[model samples]
Target: MTGLTDLFELHHDGALAENYPRLPGLLAELTAEELVRAGHLLSRVDADEVLAAQPDQRAVTTVITGPGTLDGLVAPMTAETARHGLLLRPVLAGFDSYVFVLSGDDPEIARHQPDLVLCVLDPSMITRELAVPWEAEDAERVLAEKLDLLEQLVAGFTARSDATLVLNTFPLPHELSAALVDRRSRARLSIAWHEAEVRLLRLAGEHPSVVVIDLDSLVAEGIPLTEPRMSVYAGAYLSEELLVRYAREAGHVARQITGLTKKCLVLDLDQTLWDGILAEDGPDGIAVGGGGRGDAFQAFQRVVKQIGSRGVLLAAVSKNEAEDVRAAFRAHPGMPLSEDDFVRITANWDPKHQNLTELAEALNIGVDSFVFADDSPYECGLVRRGLPGTAVVGLTEEPAWHPRDLLRDNWFTVTELTGEDRTRGVKYKQEVARKTFLSTFSSIEDYLRELDVTVHLGVATAAQAGRVAQMSLRTNQFNLTTHRLQHQDVTRLLADEDSIVFTIASRDRFGDNGIVGAVFYRRDGELAWIDNFLLSCRVFSRGIEQACLAAVLDHAFATGVHEMRAIYRPSLKNAVVREFYPRYGFTTHDHDDERTVFRHDLALPVEIPKHVRFTGEIERPVR
Candidate 1:
């Protein structure tokens, strides 16, 4: 009655479904027993009702299977999905049937065709059946067999389905070490166990569709690796606390795979970035990097820069004068970030929320893609209320812990990092220069001609699969069919003889935008149909889409294809491109409530944009 139950009682009609949104925030205040009780309470609520209450809900088909009783995880996992505005349509696998389910032995699970699959293995899976007095060689043999089974399962699942496979590195049980107490025996056992965990972590790197959760890291955070009593009686190897944390990590991966990841990190320049206020502490008086508390602020800045290097845009909103902030950056030698590191720096008297809106506009991204961090609670509250979609990180008074707090939710987690991600900040900085030059000319054509844009449009190489898959996921606005694909899927398409996977990249007088557009189509004798076509929103309104589509049509015609058909599936964000195909003389072939198909005859050639220049399929930077 003191924790979630009390909050439940306070709700109208004592309905726990109404409290679903607040459950994640109240987790820290709950005791272990209360957390278990809360999970049970959440499990009783109708999932359909909770999803109905959410304004923006994404339903992911999930399947949970392991070598033990995992029923308890389904509830906490459901609650975690609710926290992120996601609904889980889970297919329950048989208990202790990890191999059977993963090996394609279970027909229901195999046919379920889930979007996210969570498979957790515990130490007992290997230890319980180990031979007595097993030496290092014997341990290695068993580990090899288990690894083979896992690899086979992973390969089979990935080959058959596009769902992401989530695995975990299990902690070594104490029984293994206790049974082998001698120094030599203990050393061998420990080495073998460590090698096994390392091998498990390598699966994530080997398969683009696979993600591994490190249970050892969770245990390092003071959560007990396993509940002995539960393991002995209920066959639940993972403790409830560990399961809750594991569910959170799984939720992060789900968000990333579903294209709900944050794109930018907006910071406050006062006490949040530095140790003190610039107005009161003076330019040289502030603590930045000399020693003591200043080093903490410096460390925080270093972490922010590292994050920026990974393609997350950095921005700042400060109420101080613009010159004062600029002077502070110049005066501080220990500052890891310069004015150029940020895409936008707003230093004015406007409300922080208004500045954030303007920052999103300037960057050509949505407010929801931002993660705003401020040391002041008032400012955080204002942004939270003003833009409910933006993730707000309220930093405490301690600057040393700011980095940990900011990344607690893993807002920018990605499955794979590409060259474009590493250099995104620099490209945005170049965009600022492009905008400034655009204002100098009244005619758009003159501005484009002066900019000197060069585009690369051709069959995508195997090496460009990651960038194409990334574009498929993140390019929503200009996406023709809105198909979300993974790297493995793109790789598969690249190998098909009948399918054409092509990419488009643009570089102007400013900078290279990387692989900004892609098209997936299949050829059938003399006919072709587009599977999906998308262009990055950053290149919109620059005639890149027109140029790219023209090239695609011309290529199809030259290939002896008589007609090319394209589908336009309307999404909430892609209304701007609804009439895209029709502008190029494509006639409507079929129309429905959900989608429209347009067909183009290969009788005439499509004209490329005159202002833009086409280049060979090569990736090179002007700088």
Candidate 2:
């Protein structure tokens, strides 16, 4: 069976096998069923021991249940406890832990309350009679009602303690045919069941105290059901070899989902590393192109390249001449990565901080996404002061351990790294091209006139949804009100009659800044309230924000809206835009310590900035 070994070999070398020789032997002896049972046993044993041993640091706790147990009350209750245990494991792993089954109706797991309660349920425990047919519309309704009861149980558990509650969805079984006996419509029923599970999971995720564990996706990959041994019990009956491998893989994935740190290191070239400058070294003369001491820099570059490939943005901020660097990228055969690998390159002799700021602007990414790597401590300190959000790492550390250290420091653990991440460097290069083209123009109008800047305003598409949600999370400076929104929240607002969320895309002489800006607003009679207005800092000073606002206000006025209301909510990082609303003709209507409200009468058409030219027809919500 193609198992964890194959997946591991694809990304990692034989390091895992070499490190843990006993693991293979242990795995080979146990059947898949036995391994699953053992895992549960180990979890329970570990939880009891860890909780009993360390009580002071136990901030969170969880309890989980294995599949196919149907003792009714006991099974559901145990499942709830297990769910909490699993969800809070990452949070409490460094601290204390707890797990216990309640014997009586005294549903609270223990006399002392936990800081958090995590409840998990196995779909197999719910009676076949209770299971709703996948085709029935009432299936969701029934599931919701059941979930409500489960939530209430969790509430009861956390009643004595100030613990938050979390409910996890049941993982769907792997075997399709066993669950769907109706042979003719098995595929349709399976699809429906999967959809139903997702809906239930989403509902759980939306709960105040719930973090839905997407275990269905976690376990469903690999281990095909075509094999008879694997087919039984939803293809969970794997050979002993597969079971042990699967556990380790699952554990790793779990760790990724819960791990902290999500930024990357960007390096600088030249005297930053070796004794001599690369521009003077002329490729072959450089210290990095050979054996001995050169190997360290080569190893560092290899590590940086690997990190970049794994979704971390690798950027270059150097003081050397740009042409010299370009030559090194093209001519140097020893180089691990080329010019195309870097997301942003600022090689001018300008202030390092200014270069970083320009890099941030060009990438449409926040300064927080950056971790500057330079050999000079002076430069690192300067950047730290200029861009406080950015993290800086020096090259003074051990040369041999630098690669591993860099990876450890700038680790970006994620369940899935999307396609956008892979092409990010290329995209930033295109942005650089755009900026260069803009530089050639004598005036802003000339640039806009020459480059056909088309602003396609549309309701948020699925592709654009992630970017919108990301903007809410990462954007600060230009965000009118820094209200972070989830993807579902954005979707709901877009669908609501009282609200409108629009994204702006620009394709000009350079390239496309795909959905670079998003604005969300709602109307109240004649007053149009601005909920959110944020533009990518990359497209700043391009008059794109002005154009977007103009289009929105024009649309609002034409639709019979007399006034537009906006709020300037101050944040520690957004001090640059303290007077943003006032500058845009908004009069101060109300003020408090926390927030300032401004209103503008939409009587006249606001002058569009000369640098921006709107096109391709805008469709706005009419009041």
Candidate 3:
């Protein structure tokens, strides 16, 4: 049985290898025999034993190629030895767990159920065989065969009532046999095979119950197989240190895929469980400070904070004065969180539904990803009723039990947390700052001047692609034609001669609002049509919109384009920007219930505010 020490070692090795390539070389240089020993050590470590010690309830079934399959060996072993006393039920009832080897092609295995079926394909049949190169005709034949097999598998899974199928794609070839060791030729073949595997994984994910785990990425990272020292499985004649690090990664992934957890938690403060308002209690009297009830709440806050650090976004939705909460956060010496911790906060008198809506908007996350936690049953019920998609946890019986109960709900496990997840809260706070700055200025020009705004007008880059796609999806109020695009679509637009996509980023004394706006345009000879135009609401009232319009039009006029046309397609949330085009000197040429099209002559220079400085040089495409 592996302990926490083994798990920590595995995680450290995986992180170091993936993030720092130099670490692998350094470890390899230490000793050739030491690298092999490390690989052997990692392979022997049982990840399920470490998981059992944790307070997790989910069944984690590991499949190994043997006579007794996961059901016969792993399940009973987990149930008997697990530290958390969790029910580790076998997915397969009959025979030793090793029966899964024969059941891979068995129809009964799909019907006669388990919570998780660990299917281990025969290595000899799947991996040991050389991949046949697909000529044009062979490619067609292979696709047809795989598609037919996939359809049958999908149907078999759909017929099952209780089981959720998780399919592991075939692992990468490990043999470095003399026949296969032509390095240069093997690299090209490997790339082709990898692409084929990706397509297979995508096909598997098309089924609801099936989650296709990319076994190749796992193998690339490292996985241990039992074979002779000179054999491909021994972690010799390859990057043994790198492979060991990757095997640990594979183990971590195996645990995560089977773990039961939620994505995010929504919190509320005040009388729910706390003794008094944070603002009034001055942090010390607030139940989260130190001892007694305060100790429990403090423990809860610490737990919640830890969850946030692990990719679960923490949002606050309370019916208190915003200023009071802000003051409490600033001055309360015992306060666990500052204003920066929460991704979104509704510390106003707004209804819980409204707060939740704002919270979802601010985070740019789906409502389903949110799990609302409040000590008051009424508030929880209100949220549950108003936002059906959101998972609202009620603190009905014991208010102090809320934190543990929330944790029991398993609402904070996610497979990956990108860079966007860590900085989301800070981004929202910057948005708040931008909004506050906009409110202080009486006129658009004044707002622009106070901002000391610098508008970057350079051509779009690959880095801005994600932000551009996100703005298109999330922006509602100012979006003219709500044409939601993926990152790839944005990339394509930037490359096309007929279309243009430009980004707008602003920075003032307050802070940097990174890439808050985007505009997409289509050129038709003498006229340029605005396909989509939207800005982050954070930069609203800042005259940045006007600056963007002025800049684009200036480019068009210089390029000998005579006319520019824009359309306003009304949406439920875009009432604020209905007359946006007209205000910018565009004459209303057409209107309908659905859309209002406006046109302006590019020959006439639109009035430009003096404060907004366009710094970057424009790269005009050659005719």
Candidate 4:
């Protein structure tokens, strides 16, 4: 087998650029050490060259700052970035200068604007600073002081930079707390240490762009907390193995920040969700919850259910009779998930890729948002070839590893949970009811009127920053400009006196789709610029989008703004809305291959759709 380094070297010519898309799959097959070597090989090539080769791909800059020897992390992190299809321009902070770099004291590092920053901190950094004799009061005070100083540094950095900060809860070493033989004394130190970790976790809640990765949980996941030999020999606190795992997590965060998160999980029913084929073993005979492999399969189902409970749509695709599969789900008492949990279930002998296409169409989302899992290698390979954009999780023979493999890439990770996220399954179910109701009406207008659709539009409050940011990230089909913003970015817009962040929430006879649309606009003198407009794909083809825009135009006219200019950026998925501005009585002021600027005269009198009732307040009396 040829190593990744050899492959890179073999394709060192322009062939590397041609093979860029294939690199991720090849890198995925390598071990951690091999991946790191591949990263080094990739680093030798020019980033601009690789990025320019793929003109359509978006690139993000990242800065990695920490307190120890972090040179070993660059290669692995680069490999991870390559796997994510990002051109990483990484700037590593000097050893023991995490504070200096983040505090803006290091001018060289502070000047570069990055999209994401990962701050890696280990317990040893704080432990080394503790009192020599380990006085309880002294330890507590030092921990508090260090945490406060770190908080100040983070605040200073965020105030100056727009990058999303990634922090981690430090894992406490046993020696530091267990130094005292007495359990009572040990407990005190442990509590104090954990309290400090809690403070670190709170930063994510306080700063919208800041997210804390639970390193403690990662440690619990079997990565060694520390390697004394590495610390003593090379002044490296975190083990190389730990860095490999941490790189994977940080990669996920980078992908999320850049709007590359997978929205759905497609599963193979037989031997994947459960232990055996439903057609052969029957629901009663299929091993599911008693013990051993059955218990593992049940646990995996529970994991899938939990994932579905939080926004990620679940679907099952199997090569079996539809009736038998539905009957199996009905008869299996140990099944953690009912058919209702799934957004779609296709049980037939169709190719999984074709079924996935149908599922994507039914859900009105891109297949790139999907992650497919199956136990058979042949099936996984078929889907991989057929739907290259879809992520495939090939289940191993060991049932115990099923859940772990499914989540290895953090495909459905979100920075924060919202009210909408908690009720996504219920909302999808409501959508089914709405679709069923749609068939009963003769005309689209009559159907919309009968559904009693009402859109509630308002200037967004501070609390809706998360949902607005989520819409900015997840919405692509009906999105104009496809501008990705973080929660802090949305909050900043809300706080700006010259800006209006309008949120659109819809409710009908079925249910309320919470905050499904956001329109970001700013006033410049007498002219208003709509920076971006995003409407959830779930609410497309309805009059809600037009109604929301009509209300916005009315609000601008009421505020005495004569003209509104909106931007539309062309993207692969957002081309469906290419004429959205023109369709709404806006004429193109200027246009090129990249974007079109459309201008609408507010005096033209925009009218909301009669079928859709729009009720909202738009702040008036502008300059």
Model 1 global lDDT (CA atoms, 0 to 1): 0.82
Write the number of the candidate with greater TM-score, choosing between 1 and 2. 1
| Candidate 1 structure quality by residue, lDDT tens digits, 208-236 | 99999999988888888889899999999
Score candidate 4 by TM-score against the native: 0.92
Give per-residue CA lDDT, model 2, range 446-487, as digits (tens): 876776666766667655655676666556667777766544
Residue 310's lDDT within candidate 1 is 93
Selected candidate, larger lDDT, 1 vs 2: 1
Best lDDT goes to which candidate? 4
Worst 10 residues of 1 by lDDT: 614-623
lDDT of 3 at 122: 23
- Could you give the candidate ranking by TM-score, starting with the highest? 4, 1, 2, 3
Tens digits of per-residue lDDT for model 4, 312-374: 889989999999888888888888988989977899989989999988877777888889999
lDDT of 2: 0.56
| Root-mean-square deviation of Cα positions for candidate 3 versus the true structure, in angstroms | 18.5
Give TM-scores for every candidate, taking all chains together and pairing residue i with residue i.
0.92, 0.55, 0.50, 0.92
- Write down the RMSD of all candidates, one decimal each: 4.1, 14.6, 18.5, 2.9
